[model samples]
Target chain A: MKELSRRGLLGLGGALGAAALLSACGEASGSASSDSLSTPAKLRVWFMKDSVSDKAQAWLKQEFENKFQGSTLTIEQQEWDGIVPKLQTALASPESTPDIIELGNTQAPTFCAVGALADLSGMKEELGGANLTKSLVELGSFENKMYAAPFYAGSRIVFYRKDMFQKLGLAIPKTIDELTAVATKIQTGNPEKNAHFSGMFLPGISSQSAFAWVFSNGGRLAVQKDGKWEGGLSSPESQKAIAQLQQLWTTGSTTGTITDSTIGSQPYTAFNTGEAGMFFGFNFHLKKIKKELLDAGKVGYFNFPSPKGDAVGNPFAGGSNVAISNNSKARGLAKEALKLIFSKPFQEFFATEGGWVPGNLNYAAALGQDELSKVTIEAVRNSVGTPAAKNWALVESAKVVDDFFVAMGALKDPVGLAKTADAKMTEILNSK
Target chain B: MTVTSTRAKPEGTLPDRTEPAAPRKRRRNPLPYILLLPAVLIVLVDMGYPLLRQITMAFQHFSLEQQFGKPAEFVGLDNFTRVLGDSAFWLTLGRSLAFCLVCAALTMAIGIGGALLLTKLSRPVSVFVQAAMLLAWAMPVLSSLQVFQWIFDSRSGVVDWTLAGLGMQGMAGYNWFSNPLTFFAVAAILVIWMSVPLVVFMVYASVTQIDESMLEASTLDGANGWKQFREITVPTIAPVLLLVTILEIIWDLRVFTQIFILQKNGGITEQTNVLGTYVYQVGLSGGDYGVASATALIMLLITLLLTWRYVTQFLKQGEV
Candidate 1:
């Protein structure tokens, strides 16, 4: 009983202190995070790991110091997976704000929409002006103003096993049917190597890659019907694309029981392991394939064939976008950092070292590094962005997304399944 | 006799001493609670505050915009109504319930069997068994999850190779995560494997505390080993078993890291998702805090309902 009393007093005291601290931290009117200084001398710039490769770090450091003479630019490299939550937490506190950050190109709209990104309309010309890719910029725009600058563009290419294709007596496919035929033949011919081989590694989880399919068939994800966003999944072109993709999953691709990409399997991993005859992945996969295989000669690359004969490869262009934080203490230094990033010298490193096509259109010459570079560059040039809609993120994160793809993988009737999914997608998209 | 007792009071006896001698000088000092104050402070600051904050946030129409200085509008039960109406919330809750119950039952069964086996073994053998269980228990969830993914990997997992060696044609490197059953099986197996050690330890400790005289008495009365265990040993460890069961249920219900990591590894996020992972995906990834928090509170309510009996039993035992 004496022990109980002591424990009770201690618990009460701790609970009181905790409640007080919580209210102090959570209350909007609290001054716990306020700063008296008008300007912060040191600007903290948080970027994802591998965004700036080792080769460009030296040049970037010198440029930042030279550009912003008295101040310092502290670059904190964060991993891709943890950056979102960390950014959210930092954005919630004025004291922990970083001056600049890099967001995934697809995720930029959500951040911009949520008021986490600074308005970059003032520093437009200094960053890139007319030289930036229009589609990439559109992804970062909200309410008729740009919030982010296109940092890099990663385009997909069809990486194939050269020897396997040669053994099957096939040339690089030019049309969607030809590619499907090649994958089928290769998968069927060599049962030993091809039993586990997905003739093509098109993951059900990869909606971006899947979107490219629908778009290449001339279907938009959303159409401006009556001045409001309406989903296009039920359209004839989309149905046609879904039907073809469903057919691929039924006969040409691996069983749903074999591979799932959202579970973390990379298209490149299968291709490198020789378990896939063909794969569609970023051109950045070339380095990984080279490192894994130890010899780059064994692999070959080609453009994703269109349904139209010999038309340009049109992939879903994906990359990171650079943005100044809305809560940033030093916007001037961040702009200076952006100036260096946009320069010819810095942009060239993206291709030669970083394996990304620079967002600047003039840096197209960087594609001379490898044979696959040209195919990927062409795809990026002709690529389409996800529809500029407010509810795109909501639709992407909806439960129906998985069910829709799983149904496709299960070989459901494409038209019926797509129509059902379209209704759900529209519901989520229409949510405020 | 009264006269003789009064004669002894003339010595060094100071009156009748009716004050109870200050509780006979208690052995344990009251200051130990003071020593524990720091740990209590840390837990309240780190864990207790966040939980209370989460509960409060559940009622507000909060968003990323309100994370900084913007005030959250109090919406009463609207968030709960919205979440309870969501089709996905119900689906995920159903999945979580099924997964947790199955995992908890399996773990308890396996743990009890393993504990009984340990008792029958020699000291060295039992120690080695305990050590093995401890090793698995000590392994980090993420690292073991990675191993599990590789073990079930379609292209190169050993499960497929063994299946092929058995003359199964298309069973090699099976993507175990795509199917709901296979995904749950894999998740359950990992959870059970990780949790069995704690249950085993608790059962073993309680079993050892059973009086040897009771076992001997049951045996001498012509009862067999199994009969003695059922009548005497089981009753002796009943409370421990109940405690372990309650804990296992709670742990299984709240499982997040393993499923989340596996989803990240296997790309079957939608199909393989449980309540904890679903909450994170919706709340953090989808930025739908209202729905996530409401779902979480519902999970808490479900847990409370399920464990109410055990809690009452424990409280009754405490009073006794």
Candidate 2:
């Protein structure tokens, strides 16, 4: 009986050990060094969803492969939802890291500071040195060394239904207050008598779109004073912006309840469904609007208006930066492919096909001289960017700003929430 | 049963000589040890390594910089101190505990009731119900999450449509994920709905093994159905119940997927965070690995402490 009990105990111990171990598996780490320029190697490139047009991706892949016979270049499209964490893990080891990557311009500083990307300082002149977007260059550089290169730039434009405006005898709003009044008028008018109609599809979770109000009101998300970063959401200018936004949420839109990021990012969806009179979106969302609306000349767009009916408003600059991973085994080959990505044809694709301001300002003329393209260029010219802090990506990941705006949209106590959010932002920004 | 009886006959006859036979049994045998070596080594390499690394990381200042190539400095309980001092950690812990207990209780109650009902149903009906439950259990979590999101969607969802149709005008365009209370309510329902089937299967299997003769005798003695169940069925299935309850508690305490996915749709992420999501947000999203590891270690201890009594009672029963 003693021996039997001891054997049983051994079995039980083994079972428990196995059960506990099943929960976690360590990530494998390995290093490789293969820098031969002539050797044929498969190069993998990662582009964010909706950032690169299919034509651009295909042209780059073909051009690179043609330039280097026997080498294959593959483009993998990744989602933006959790790209930061995914990059953190994937970029840690040589075996798993993609050779080339496209990250949000805002996220470039984080990767650059952490030494996740190869230094591009030597090729700065070769890749458009002075012609690259100025703000993007500032963001992609760390300690005076450039890492990621600006791929493209864009800013939000307000897309409104001309038919609705004509029916309601409304003209294009020229100021922030006038825009709110127009949205409210449309909401109350209910021209189509649709249930759940939003005059402006500005969801609380679309914090990027909401940034237009703050920026146009002379407010910033964060500001550096005496080399110390402080949250700017509680500033008087920002408080005024929040008050105006709250008023819009209360009377101008019913989409304040939308919390899903997917729906928040795609403002054109509600506009296409006829549930919204206007939406703040990128120029590329033009393709997403219904063909019927476009054919009927019902769809129109304009740059975000200023606060006092002055010049154009400064909306958040929306764009991406391309870089080569430091861990790539074929560093030489990756740089060659990156050069192809910035060539005239590939760069023009950004303007012509993707409806974006090309990173190389020289090629932006390919976007044509149409009214829409002119407005898009003007918006991008006046665009503002987030604080160029090293840890700004961490704040984005923590969703502090997004949550603050979401609370305001819900009509919560904005004063208390803004103070709390600012403090959290300060702590994270300063953390080593 | 026949094999045990046959073997016991010889032991019964030689009871006086058992002491002498024990010496022969005590002789060293390497076969069992050799057989266990493969599994033991696999467990150590597979699970033991990660656990050791996590424990070490909990004591060090590890972050994204350290993850790349920087040397991690030993912090020696600094991570623990910071996590414990933070008010957010305490709030998350309290919320996790409340959510876990509520989900486990609801799952168990409904599971047990379903199992009892199955026992009284006709054979075909029981089989149909069991089959339906098997499908629900086998469905992938992501698929179920997609369906549940659709059902509770703020716009064009069946729930709001039905409520509005019933003349609740305000129910139109109601967002379930905007408010924290409704956010958790939806998450709890999803967790319980997915878990109840397993408990039902386990309890039903154990309850069928109960002795029919004892139940018949109690019935003959004019005992009511509830009285017979309390007297006989409870004791017969006590072991299974104890095991199931402990497993449920552990599983629910560390629930991550349902809550994490639902939180993506809800705007109030901080307000709705439980321990699992909190750790993920801090470590993966916040890029602070040290504090996350410390928090996870604390969570593991809490789970073990909560289940210690039941685990000991189970081992004692096994010994008997």
Candidate 3:
């Protein structure tokens, strides 16, 4: 009340200012982001945390710098959490966007559908053509245009303590039931000695690992029919898988409630410390175990086994898809870098250095005769992917599978939770 | 990058009023308005544009498609209706409000108590305490969260070890983030720990500003320490108290970094999500900006409602 004169004056000024601001915003024209710049001086790229091997980074930098002299290439590492929002805002602006980026395969569709990536359909042959990881290429495409090229891929295999297995007179499980039985026997036999020991460290929120259980049992997360997507978790097959996983949780896993990858009760840490007899982890986890454990010849791994006891179980194909940013000024250089990433020398680093199956199948055989690589290759060949729904990224982001598995860990009614979770999955997958 | 708008500039750099002018504008000189040109324009462009954009998006059918320069259709109250109808929204709001209130109350109590203790302490000790509080306040949230994570880590946390040593053997290797209740408890402790310092500093500064002679008069008049504190000290610092309270409420209501970071480590996202994280999940993660904006608008209103009383009191005190 005391400042009415000033307030009135300010209000009048603000009204005029608002009129000016509205017109300014209304005139922000669309930028031509996809145009290739001629000989850009600097290029920026982003790689996810720990996604690329150091050797590959070194090779990529040296080669890119050599190919484009007088141009500087910068590689920034990004983290998985909160990256969607970061990418959404950053990729929308040409000035803010990186020239090249490595996208998580699961998140590729969202950016692809939204036209946040440059169309790479014309460069398919240059990007390894038939040698690309089939599932990733399928995932990174939207409306029949390739936006992201398949990068390296990896699949989870079952890692176990060889010493403990021999001491307990257990065989490498060839069937899903035998796997559970072996785990239960080991945990039951030595409960008094190791109070917090687990036969297998299958955390509840590890949806990537838990995905094996669902896929191996012939259950789909969602299915499409006549331009509509519906939840398949309520199906008998999924329920059976959920039941089997819950049984494993109750009987064989002491780390059932552990949720994340790097947290307490992490599979690698537990296995290295002799707290776990088995764990389902990516192929690289063998190297992550304690050196002493490796020196003791205690570590062994096998492919996730099928129910019929003869073949490898279907694993979730985990990987990244390298793409040039849609807003990048140096698309020509970025395309060269992308092509280089798919080349034999660069692709071989995935197997030789990173412990992953190369994105190019031609180089995947370079891992020739290594025990772990053979298992991973077999697993990758048998891998199943999340449904290629346009909104599947939304489903992953929503954490429906993680929630469902965590509920399972808490010993909730599996059938009911799966049904409820199924509905949520359907809702997110069909939102588009 | 382009500066092509006529509204931002006209004729020359300066407008001429020396010649003929409209009758309404003749009495009022436009010099003050011209003086405010640069600052006002900056504010209009910086804060005004996003505020307007958000308000526009809140009513539109905005999603992935519309994000890429595609035209959005006006959806009226659809987003609001969907958010209101969802039971999860209500649950999350209730939890978030309760969490905010509890955190604010605890922070204020600890802060006020610390301030009182500081007033009674020797100069050196008080300075040391202030320094420690400042350190806690100065620590980056991400680094502090990492420390909290280490402290509550199931496998090797000191809290778990100490609790187990005290004969709660079952607490050994206890997962603090395994369940929702435990997750919130840990998060609340972290939030309160980080927030209490500001309240302490503010209350302490205000208490020191109170006239000592007034307290001496009250003491001589048979007013005990508690009595004078309640009668004189309370009334004198009431403005600062309300101001701090208002700020604390706002900070607590929008608590995001701690909860968001912890969610990435463990706990069910559905169980642990507060309004901030929920909005982020829907808008950015789930790619539904319309619902997220509507949710955020509702959250803004709720915050306003909660802080309205304290804010009005503070403003009134300012006038007096």
Candidate 4:
């Protein structure tokens, strides 16, 4: 009898404890509003790695704090990997959510559509008006309501070794086919006689880099038809691009089998080793190039060449979009801080310090009139973006496109793989 | 006082004095119950809440919208039916089971062999081997993953370098992670390597505790080493072996870090996903919390079923 009563009491205690905890969780979720514009509330902002330069970060903090007396703004750096899941959980609660978050441009539509971000339709004109990057603005909107603002934009460009070109008596490639021919010639020539040399340091896992070929050939990753999204990899233009990319993998590059994204991002590593004659990378990667190579005038840049040589190829627009979480307690204060972020100094810092095309094109003049800047601005101008579908982030997280290209890089049967990948993409894109 | 006297024995003995003590015992002291309250509360709050939430979510249509304050509609068996109907889930299940069995078997074989060898080694050599195994076991998973990635790297990996130097010129830049077979091979190697030390230590400790007299008795009966082992050591350590095997099966079946980190490096994520990563992909990455919860529940049932017989036998032995 005693044992039974004790067990019952223990069960009752557990039930009471669980009930109390659940009620506590429920109570904390009731959001507190910003009492006044100048109220001293500490704001937390999350920025992705490598997105904001240290100088820009410090300046933003200092400027925001100076403007809003007694209120502290704390900036936390976040990694790009696994950030989607992190945001999904973090943005659900008032206490856990950062006041502002910088998500990848491709991921903005997901957050925007799900109501995780605060609607910024009223402040759109005040932020950048029509001067904001159009594609980014489109990606950061859902049902005509703006949720995120363009942070900055950049695109890949061909960075080749001028010494290698001069040594081999090769002219700058003017078209897609010409680029391939040049790469093949360099690979066969092996001017440095390095056994591990590759004409182009293109890794298969760098699906964003390969997007240049697809977009240049007038193909998209996905397209909406009759209000239903369909995968575009099996289209004629995409197939042709894949064939050309496979040709490059077979004859001009030995880095196609590389599946590591970290290695994919660092194309200049092989270039620095004097083994890679050329690499496709961001203008920001210029800072990462060997100083000796730059001083010797061996480094040169070019926009990705088009197939017909009529225009620059459309590389993927790589950038971020900043948004305030809807769950943020201090929405008004966050808006004020966001105004400082879009100010002239902060916008110009993107060009002068970070080597990215600023989110606002108005401050692009600070990038200087150098050839490198011209190519970078031109690349960003012609750049394409991933599908703005609401579930595009899910597709990316699933890595369907990345896996398909990795197989293509391995010289697999592209036709079958493209069919499978297209089906997967379509299924994911149309899924709720 | 009359009621107490009626409850007690009427004999003029110690029983007459214990009647007062019996009433004292019935007074119900609250100290023990109070002492248990905090522990009970902690367990309920920490583990019980998440479990309750997961079970409830399995029957709901939960997604990112629902996660962000939207109403989640209860879908009854929809999530279960969807997960069970998917071919991908079945494929992942088969792959996970195969990977788990292979890894567990290999780890057990190598661990048991090493433990037996330890019994034969000198004290200093045994101590050195134990220390090395301890270090390997204690090394962080992330640090080991980084080293493994470098070793298997396509461009400058030592594996490719060594293979190329051995006249296998075709392997000079062979990408280990590009192929699914080789990807799982690397993952399985890592899983077994990380887990073998624990198994070795456990088996060794138990093996040393076996009675030496029984082994000598078997040997005097003209029994060979293998025969003595099968007759004496096997039965003596059967319970420990069973427990370790069950633990290995569970650990390997739910192996996450090695496969997940390798899949990130490798491009064959879909082909290489085990059950642990599959749940993560479907729930966290894919944002289908309902279906993921259902799949996780199914995985739990399968694990329970797999270990049910052994667990029962373990309990029976404990009772004995």
Best DockQ among the predictions, by candidate number? 2
Candidate 3's TM-score: 0.90
By DockQ, the candidates rank as 2, 4, 3, 1
Residue range A1-432, candidate 2, lDDT tens digits: 444454344333323322332232224243464657799889999999888899998899899899999999999999998788778778878878899999898889998998788899999888998999999999999999999999999999999999999999999999999999999999999789887689999999989999999999999999999988899999998999999999999999988778999999899999998899999999999999999999999999998999998899999998989999888889899989988888899999999899989888989999999989999999999999998898899999888998998888888888899999999989888888
Give the DockQ-based CAPRI class for model 4: acceptable
Q: After TM-score superposition, what is the CA distance of residue B161 in candidate 3 from its true location, in Å?
A: 1.7
Which TM-score values does chain B get in all models?
0.87, 0.92, 0.89, 0.89
Off by over 4 Å in 1: A1-44, A65-86, A95-98, A161-169, A191-198, A255-265, A273-275, A290-300, A369-371, A397-403, B1-44
List pairs with backbone clashes in candidate 1: A262-B267, A263-B265, A263-B266, A263-B267, A264-B267, B160-B173
- Across B1-320, the per-residue lDDT of candidate 3 in tens digits comes to 12224333443445453435433443364554665587668765765665577678789888866766677889999999999999889989998999999999999999999998999999999899999999999999999999999999888889999999999989998888868899999999999999999999998999999999999888889999889889988899898888778777877877778998898777589988998888888887777877887887787778778876776676677777
DockQ of candidate 1 against the true complex: 0.23
Q: TM-score for each prediction?
A: 0.86, 0.94, 0.90, 0.92
Global CA lDDT computed for model 2: 0.86
Pitting candidate 1 against candidate 4, the one with the higher TM-score is 4
Interface RMSD of each: 6.7, 4.9, 7.4, 7.3
lDDT for B2 in candidate 2 is 51
For model 1 chain A, give the 10-residue run with minimal summed lDDT. Answer: A27-36
B1-320 in candidate 2: lDDT tens per residue? 45345445545666644577644543344444565688678756665665677788889898777766677899999999999999999999999999989999999999999998999999999999999999999999999999999999878789989999999998887889888888989999999999999999999999999998988999999999889778888788988888788888878888888988898898788998988888878877787887888888787778778777877787676676
Tens digits of per-residue lDDT, candidate 3, A1-432, equal: 334443333333323322322232221113664444356557788999867888888898889888878777888999876677778667766777888998888888878888778899999987788978889999899988999888878888999888888889999998888888999998987633787788888888777787787889898888897888888888887787888788888898877778654643356877776788999888777778999989988889999988888778998878888898877777878887888888888888888888778778889887768788788888988988888778887887787877777778767887787778888987887776
Clashing pairs in 3: none
Worst 10 residues of 1 chain B by lDDT: B22-31
